[model samples]
Target: MVYRHLNEKDRFYIEQRLSEGDSLRSIARALGFSPSTISREIKRHTPIDFKGLYCHRLTSRCAQEKRANAKQGQAFRQISEEAKMLIHQRLSTHTSDQATLFRTNKLQ
Candidate 1:
């Protein structure tokens, strides 16, 4: 399924459910998402101060920033640490010019 940003309605619902002491799992089931997803949505859209009080505006702004940052990178560029080390080692060995080009493309 394609991912989409949450609308104000969804945010409002999250706030409402949280305020009502609903568990993350319950909220997730209600919204047809995974529990971890619901938890992360709350954390992303509900930044808390040192005192741990949620600020809706700040949370929304954070969510906007996250979305903007995500758009800057290609999804498939994500690589594991071991894979990264292997790539670096291969580059050091200079086995293939095409490998270097592919690595450079990923860096960009």
Candidate 2:
């Protein structure tokens, strides 16, 4: 099954509802998402100290870092402007192969 992700606004709303002492089920009903989703978000993103204050920027950055770190020990691929320019130059000169160009190079 495909999962639909919540937006930044929804995340902030969840934090707000959590801060306002609303039950997880109530917030889930209001947002039309499963209670498990709410529970997971809260558990994953909550501050270690459990302070009531919520910072959207911090939460978003933390989530991004978490995603990035999950792919550790993978092969590294360079994607700098210099590399792109070289590829473009090859394509312009008809020296690059289409199969190689379409290959998925995972970035570290």
Candidate 3:
């Protein structure tokens, strides 16, 4: 089976099923996911203060924020400021002989 991240629609469906007092296993079966997946989703998104209530809108917002923050953190970790400056400097200068050769050959 292919792995994929749950989207807003799936979260909303989960919310709807939960509201109808459906069991996690039943919801997971209908959604073609594992019961553990449904259980984890509920556990992760349901606020501690809200008791058992699960809001799809809030869950989606939280997921988006987490994804954005993770992406930003990964980008920073992959490239340092010094490396960025070096790349900028190289780009601002004339093309190197190797680059010119590659470009010329690609045109042929």
Candidate 4:
């Protein structure tokens, strides 16, 4: 099966199923994911103040915030203009040793 990230709808289903006291394995089977995935989702997203309640909105928000924060660390906005220019120059010239170039130039 093709791998895919769980969306808000899937999170909602998980919340509903969890509220109904469904087993992790059952929820996983219904969602076409592994039981470990379900378990991990619950473990990771269950808020400390919620005391183990699997809230879809809270979980989704936390997941979104996490993704946003992670992206901040990897954003193009973080790249220096000199590095960007170097990359453009290398690409324009069909150079393949970008890593070596970056290392030599102390850009990495």
Candidate 5:
């Protein structure tokens, strides 16, 4: 599937499934995502004071607020630690580079 972020409807579904006592794996299956994705979504949006609680509306609002507050490059062109090291030890990273350095190390 093409990569896309979760939306309010998805969050609402997640909230509903969670309220109905569904497992994260099951929820992920129904939503076409990995169990870890569902788990991380829950953990990411859970209210700290409530520990395990997730509210879709609040999550939506928070997400909007975050987007509105986001700064440029906060989500793009993030050089990896290995990439950073390559720059200091080797040279700046860029497109059309030789295969000698900056091979795909891995992703987080």
Candidate 6:
């Protein structure tokens, strides 16, 4: 099975079904998702002040903010232009590929 993130439409559907007094299991079945998935989504996005109410618009915005924040610390940040120029200069002057590779790996 492939994993997929739910979109705004799915959130709207959930909100609609919830407002209609549908059971979580029924909503899950209708949406072709597990009941626990639906349950968790509601729990994750529902504000404490909302008193169990689920708002799709607010939930979507909250999810977007979380995703944006998560992208701050990526595994490999881009090298600056000056650093790239220095690397190019060093590599161009190096005679042995193996020695250059070893030095680069050591520096990292």
TM-score of 6: 0.67
**Order of models, best lDDT first:** 4, 6, 3, 5, 2, 1
TM-score of each: 0.54, 0.55, 0.64, 0.67, 0.61, 0.67
Q: Mind giving the per-residue lDDT tens digits that candidate 2 earns over 23-54?
A: 98998999889999878777777687867455
- Considering only N, C-alpha and C atoms within 3 Å, which residue pairs clash in candidate 5? none
> Candidate 4 — which pairs collide?
none
State residue 15's C-alpha deviation in candidate 6, in Å: 0.7
Please write out the lDDT profile of model 1 over residues 69-100, one tens digit for every residue: 88776753776665667678887897597876
Model 2 off-target regions past 4 Å? 52-54, 74-108
Count of backbone collisions within predicted model 6: 0
Query: Among all windows of ten consecutive residues in candidate 4, which has the lowest summed lDDT?
Result: 99-108
Q: How accurate is candidate 3 locally (lDDT)?
A: 0.80
Off by over 4 Å in 6: 74-104
Q: Residue 107 lDDT in model 5?
A: 30
Over 9-63, each residue of candidate 6 has an lDDT whose tens digit, in order, gives 9999999999999999999998888999999999988899999999999999888
User: How large is the C-alpha RMSD of every model relative to the true structure?
Assistant: 7.0, 8.0, 6.1, 7.0, 8.1, 6.5
- The sequence of per-residue lDDT tens digits that candidate 3 reaches over residues 1-108 is 899877889999999999999999999999889999989888887789889799999988887887777766464465556655555565678768576445544544
Which should have the higher lDDT, number 3 or number 5? 3
- Candidate 3, which ten residues in sequence have the lowest lDDT sum? 99-108
Residue 14, candidate 4: alpha-carbon lDDT: 96
Query: How many pairs of residues collide in model 5?
Result: 0
Q: In lDDT terms, how accurate is model 6?
A: 0.83
Provide the global lDDT of candidate 2 against the true structure: 0.72
Q: Could you say which candidate leads in lDDT?
A: 4
Q: Show where candidate 1 strays beyond 4 Å.
A: 55-57, 73-108
User: Tens digit of lDDT per residue, candidate 5, span 7-98?
Assistant: 99989999999999989899889989889988887877677997788899988888777777777567536767766565455444444345
